[model samples]
Target: FTTEDGAVNAGGSLVLFDTATAQQLYLKPGVFQNATVSAEAGVSDRKLLDEITPLLPKDATAQTGKALADRQAKDIESGLTSLNTMLLAFAGIALFVGVFLIANTFTMLIAQRTRELALMRAIGATRRQVKRSVLLEAGVVGTLASVIGFLLGLGLATGLRSAMGLMGGKIPAGPLIVSPTAVGSAFAVGILITVLAAWLPARRAAKIAPVAAMSSVHATASVKSLVVRNSIGGVITLLGSAGIVGGAASGGTSGRQLIAAGAFFALIGVIILIPLLSRPVIALVRPALKKVFGVSGKLASQNAVRNPRRTGATASALAIGLTLVTGISVLGVTLGQAIDKMTTDNIKADYMVSMASGDSLDESALRALSKADGVTALSPQQAAWFEVDGEYHSASAVTPGDVEQVFSLTVESGSLASLKDGQVAVGSKTAKENGWKTGDTLPVKFDDEKKGELKVGAVYKENEFLSPFVIPKELADEHSASTRPEIREIWIKADGGASKANEQAVVDALGDNPAMSVMDRQDIRDMFGGFINTALNIMYGLLAMALLIAVLGVVNTLAMSVFERQQEIGMLRAIGLDRGRVKRMVRLEAVVISVFGAVIGVGLGVFLGWAIGRTLSADIPGYALVIPWDRLGVFLLLAALVGVLASLWPARSAAKLNMLTAIKTE
Candidate 1:
């Protein structure tokens, strides 16, 4: 008994003793503490609860095991839900970018095999047979890739679980289960996406005429097709622009939805019009490229615009990732600014006293805090969930007179001091919603069925610091829940305002409880701001996957472009273009395309951010549109860096091409 030890690591200190010894020391006759119960094997939770419900005393409460577990794991469940949602969204974006890579790869592959396809047609192969051949190849590649990807994903999951455990996360000890549904979904999505991406390219391959086998010309999009595509894109873009403008002008939840829809359409339109946009966008940057890189830069610009479709597809992936990141950044900045302004303008208290664990303070802690020296006034607030006319709402109880000293309440009608026993003060928004005014009576009930009618004595302007319904502390105590109500917060007005001495005095008063904390105005602001920053960091981590996929898309496009232009690069090399200049040309082309996409993405993101902020401003007080220009600039710079890194291998390969072999390639 002198020393204590645990048989297992249960994430906390534990002590074990014989039943009789424990009873003698901690349990007395006719008294009992909480007990844990487990159902017999094969027994359902419902049956267990049903059997145990009648065994408890009339005044005692009983909770099912499932309910208890759910209550304990609520926060963890919420966090996981949010994490899963973000991961799924970004994963979808990655897959969408992959579509462009797969399609582009198939396009180039078919172009390289144009003669082969035409020869098959000349040998009496039907168009359907040729198309099927291409599709069958895609299916085989998809199957192999899917298997490898699934195995890698499984390994990653196991590694992550071990890492989390090493970092002190409480993970259950068991083998990881690979569900059939997940396996099925992985293969289904992979195969479907690959086949779909290759369908268009396969169609193009099938259309190659028999005569094409004797010609060196490759298939290209006709001018008529470009005109049709551009027209469709322009119309969609116009409609999307109109939606965005209307959404910004009309501020509400509906407006937010409209903005979301507008963004979707705008993204689709922009993607379609990128081929047309490539000309002007590259043209604008061509002069700067020439000024800096000289002849190499000029050649790079020409190379980029040579096949606008390829350039457009390569850039689209990066653009999509940047667009999402920029929009989220804008929203996060706006929200952080709004919170800062709201806290500074509304909170009048000199210091806030609360628990470090974020739990409610007991009555003893509140009494001790009230005895702190240099305290001019103290307002202790208690919160509880109460039913009003069958709907559950949160209610706060506080001393009416003490509230005015610690909070800035703009009285729309009546006064806070008039809120006596059997009376309550309601926020303006709540009052308007329920059609309740000063002197109106509201019927409220507690969980124990304790009911009473409270008269509304005051109507105050709504602020973030105050709850909707404020009742007297005496009235709350009379409702018969517990002997003493738990205190949620205590606002203090120090004798000489907020200072180190005042803060130390408050800390000293609560010395018996080491979990209590006293925070000044700045601390409060920082605490809330920290929450927003944490959220933004998580979002950035999730979006990194999409950005990685975009980088891969750039690499794939540049490599394929090098393969298609092998002879062209050889011709340039023969004309006295050195290896360094060849490399510079490729790098400059990537830079132009990357910068082009980043510009469009950033501009679109800013507009979307502004529209969404306008919608939120109607509901949130002090909300304003805040554009993080510095962050946007950094994103553009990173995009340019991505271009340089992506082009390294392709440029090297282009530079290393043999002059004689490349010239005689055709």
Candidate 2:
């Protein structure tokens, strides 16, 4: 009979029948892959687990319903956690960048309203009243924005679910639930962040003097304030740098956490210090601008440094995005290089054969491959877990005679020839960790209680290509609990190396099993490289959102700058500066700011990458720091391009201004 599809059987057909009838029709007596046991209503799953625990075999495990469900969902949960973390990180970056944009907007708005604020003060408005008014306006804007954002987020989630389903991912069939907590959090965060961003501008507005109602000068931060900010920033930066160095030297999980904390503080410190940094950085680029665009370029450079704080805030957003992207690129490149070095240094086989689905190869498939044309020596590897002194350790079983043909093993203290029955080869790292040495005896037991003792025949140097413990195939076959040993991979040395003909012969021998894959050394390297590239691409995609916000910040800053510099631009136009030159000036200023941010970002990213790589070196064999110079150069070039793109509208607006009207304005 047809059965309703549940979460476990979503996207697939299901049928139900009486267990006795099914056994009579399709099953042999006492034969089944698995059986499900359930308790009556009101019985707890813990009681079921307790009852089954005593009846289970030594190797079997009894889990409660919740435990079993969690175990089964562990991988999916881990994947979702990773995905959510990445999304949240990028989202936070975007929000952080938006903070700068929001702050700048409020600052400019208050600056323009200086006279109005001064008038309010002259009419007996208290500083608190003026501050509260600005904050109230911010709160209203925040509420509206929050409502819009929440609706958009709901739409986006729905779209993502649909897309996942279309891509063949299983999705539970139900309406998406919107929790009260989520709604509350959305409004709370939006309003709080907006009000906080506006606070500084509101304070500045309140500081406007009553006498300033008769003046035309715009409100700006005092020298004392700038000095205080720079001092605080410098102190924070120094602390962050120390933490990074300590984390790198320490090297572990705790060290990584320290590094993360250091990175956050370092980023914030750098952002705070950028206003002080902008002047010198722009000055350094001034000469190049002069050489390229002459007077217009010089004008752009001067204008960029005119408001260092504004320039710094706009550029800081871009810097944050690029820093993350560049750091990830460095790590990805380093990992790819490490894998390439490991494979090249250790693997000697002409070709490697394994299941594409990562399942075990059957004896028949192994036998067929051994008899394939152009095959000279073949080493089949089997993986099994053995309990050694009550600790389960994974061991790889290999043909002792044929291993040397497939792998370039460096014996540190013993000989490979001694790795026979009742003998094992231990990797140096594993040996060091467990205090194992050559000739040390290990009492081991298979899951089926097949007991054996193995002597450490050899202690070899660490090799990333091989398992920590190596055992003879004969010994594994004798002690393994399974009816047959599970062959994980077969390393093949063809008669004429890795040629297409030899690869085809091997494939032909296996009858072209869809589950299996035959790969050369380069193919294996490429497989790992593909994984790294995919991860990098995903990161780049996420970081693009932050970069987009940064671009908008640049656009917003340039637009405001153009508005502020109207009279100056009018004077330049009266002196014969054309629309094209004005546009070029605006674009060049954007480029200078963009390049300045990119330089800091790239430098910080490389340093952070190096620090992270140092932490990984102890665990990863042959790990080395690799800098992808070409990629960094490309990122810098893209930053310049982003500037050019960001300036399009602002430049156009500046060019179209009425010169006479602008010059006549107060």
In candidate 1, position 550 carries an lDDT of: 80
Q: How far does residue 38 in candidate 2 sit from its true spot (Å)?
A: 7.5
Cα-based lDDT at residue 120, candidate 1: 88
The top-ranked prediction according to lDDT is 2
Error of 1 at 176 (Å): 1.2
In candidate 2, list every pair of residues with a backbone clash.
Answer: none
Q: Mark the 10 consecutive residues where model 1 has the least summed lDDT.
A: 3-12
Per-residue lDDT of candidate 2, residues 251-341 (tens digit): 9988888888888888889999999999988898899889989889999999998988899999898899999989999999998888778
What would the TM-score be for candidate 2 when compared with the true structure? 0.91
lDDT of 1 by residue, 1-666 (tens): 443322233344446766666554445444456567788999987898888889988876677777877876796678689768867777788888888888888988888888888888988999999999999999998999899989999998999888878878655556798899999999998998899999999998887787954486578788998999899989898888778878888888788888878888888889889999999989988898899889999999998899998888888888888888898899999999999988887777888888877777877766786788998877777876578899887777777677787887898997787776557888999899989999987888874578877788899898688689887777776773544466778988898889989988888888845778788989989888889898889788878887888888788888988888888889999999999999999998888888888888888888888888888887778887888989999999999999999999999999999987898887
In candidate 2, position 404 carries an lDDT of 79
Tell me the spans in candidate 1 whose CA falls farther than 4 Å from its real position: 1-83, 166-168, 241-255, 384-393, 420-423, 439-455
Off by over 4 Å in 2: 1-34, 37-79, 165-173
